[model samples]
Target: MRRFDSAQPILAGLVSAVVGYASSFTVVLAGLRAVGATPAQAASGLLALCAGIAATAVFLALRFRMPISIAWSTPGAALLVATGHVQGGWPAAVGAFLVCAALIVVAGLSPWLGRAIAAIPRPIAGAMLAGVILSLCTAPVRAVVDVPALAIPVVLAWAVLTRFARQWAVPGALLAAVVAIAVRGVHLTGVSIAPAAVLTVPTFNLPALISIAVPLFLVTMAAQNVPGMAVMATYGYTPPLRGVLVTTGLASAFAAPFGGHALNLAAITAALTAGPDTHPDPRRRWVATAALGAGQLTLGLGAGLAMALVLLSPPVLVIAVAGLALLSALGASLASAVTDPSGREAAVVTFVVTASGTTILNIGPAFWGLVAGGLTALLLYRRTRPSSPPDPTPPSPAATELPSPTAAGPAASR
Candidate 1:
């Protein structure tokens, strides 16, 4: 068993767990509600999703030589919300979960897919990532339209502070928004607040997989997995793609019955573990991912208490906190996307398309954003430099032989 000398993995894991869970949970709740989940059902379902990500984050991060954290697919939420509206019930969504899990596992195990992931140009991948985040960044703003007096100014204030102040922008903006909401006396009077109960047993049936399981699986993979690995690579942590996919698959496979539809590598949550804040030695920090699993277990056990807290907090708080928490990550990706002169235009196109929230055939924008960005990169940046590839050879546990992801490509498929 491999391990690191620094205590940073443990420290990073603790912080990453709390911040990532809280932020991602908000999205998960939105996802449940979008699917018309009862308030208690929504809380329990989000807890399950967190449980899945936390498990994968810990297992894969510990085994792989990178700070590999997992996260829920926020983009998938948009797709599922639409899916829930059309599909008739949660059974179809669960079916999507099962199918997506199978797909994720298959993709993880397949070397061709891993090769394909690695082959994508950095500029294109960066653009796709920006596209994903930009969409999420704008969600709070658009939510205001649903509750204009409430969601609008909160988003606008966040934008203004972010544009003007820069450093303290996200936190400050979130705080300001919270204060604004409070001043206006917007309370959750109609919202249900009773403690949520957990569904210990998973609901399963073959027919349900078709309507709910398959699409949810596709949405999770398209929206979450590909872009997440990109973020890991962007920051220079190159863990095995096979390991991650397998972990995500296992997580979802287990979580699906519990109504956790989407669980994969978390680009946003990963920033906490992948950045300079985690560890100077990339190899040392993978343990932190494992720690997240521990955190998930902790959260799962006390979900009733967690729901109590959520019921009390304002909706704007969730958006503002998530927006702020992701600001650093968002900036880093945007910087990566446009820094290369050749890839600049393609990246911009990717960002705009993703941010647009336009859907085709009910598929969300992340898929199209990646498609558009990849095509643009293909057309504009034809001269892609493929550095010396990793030796397509047998495994070695010794640290030196482990090729850096940036040095070679995304994780080598099994």
Candidate 2:
């Protein structure tokens, strides 16, 4: 078992949990509603997602001795919001969730599929992610115009907190929202304190399977899981990818019956736990993720209350808070997509197509965005791709000893 010498990791974990749960929760609620979920079912979905992410984060961090942060797929939730009220409603959405989970499990089990996911062009992935969240990102301005009294205070709090305590910016904004709503007498008439889980039987529908499942799976993988892995690599922690994928996929499957959509490696919060700020020693950083898991579990117990708060507030106001929370992620994605000049045009095309909200063949813009961007990149950038230069430096001592992914177990697959 690992122990921490300082409490900084614990604090970081706490902040990560707060930000993770608070920032995108409205999006989750909106997604559930778009899929025709009742308020109770949406609350159940929140609980299930929090439970799944907590369990996976704790288990993987302990088992692998690595900082592994797990979270609900916000981009997948956004895709659900975009899909909006399929034929079979919430049950069909549940079925789509199950399908996505199964696909993730397959990807974990099959090295080729995992490699294929990894092979997706970074610019395309970033663009698709950017597109998914575009609507929510624009809500803040609309909210301010519609209800300046509520939106301005929350935005101001976010801006102020971002300057002083960057990690607490979203949480502070959320607190401001709560105060504003309450002060305005937004009564929580039917809100309940007791949390309860509700099980939903899945109803399979082909339209949802195509529009919701496929796109959700792709966005979750490309936007969240892939970036999460890259963040871990930046911290020099080479976790076993197969183990991670399998764990998260199983967690997602477990939560589906309770209405949770998708769970996977976390991109934003992973930085908090994996960085030197958590702990100077890389080996000890897993404790931060363990702490994060615990925090998530604690918060999960209050899903009913959280949902009630969201329900009591005006929809646009909740949306405005969500938009504020997602701004950082949106900026990061856009920056990543255009950072390379070679892929800039393709990335821009992908972003525009995705943001356009144009659906074709019952499929959402995300899928088409990827296809269009991929084709553009292939046509324009293929010739410009620099051929691998011959290595002038000798291989490191560890290079020959390191096994390929198949032999290395999980890490090789990643």
Among these predictions, the greatest TM-score belongs to: 2
Error of 2 at 212 (Å): 1.6
Highest lDDT, which number? 2
**Residues 120-223 of candidate 2: C-alpha lDDT, one tens digit per residue:** 76767788788878898898999899999999999999999999988788888999999998899877676785677899999997877887888888888888
Segments of candidate 1 deviating more than 4 angstroms: 1-7, 82-84, 112-153, 156-197, 200-219, 231-237, 296-414
Q: After aligning candidate 2 to the native by TM-score, how far in Å is the CA of 181 from where it should be?
A: 0.6
Span of 10 residues, lowest total lDDT, candidate 1 = 405-414
lDDT of 1 at 177: 53
TM-score of each: 0.62, 0.87
Q: What local lDDT score does residue 346 receive in model 2, on the 0 to 100 scale? A: 75
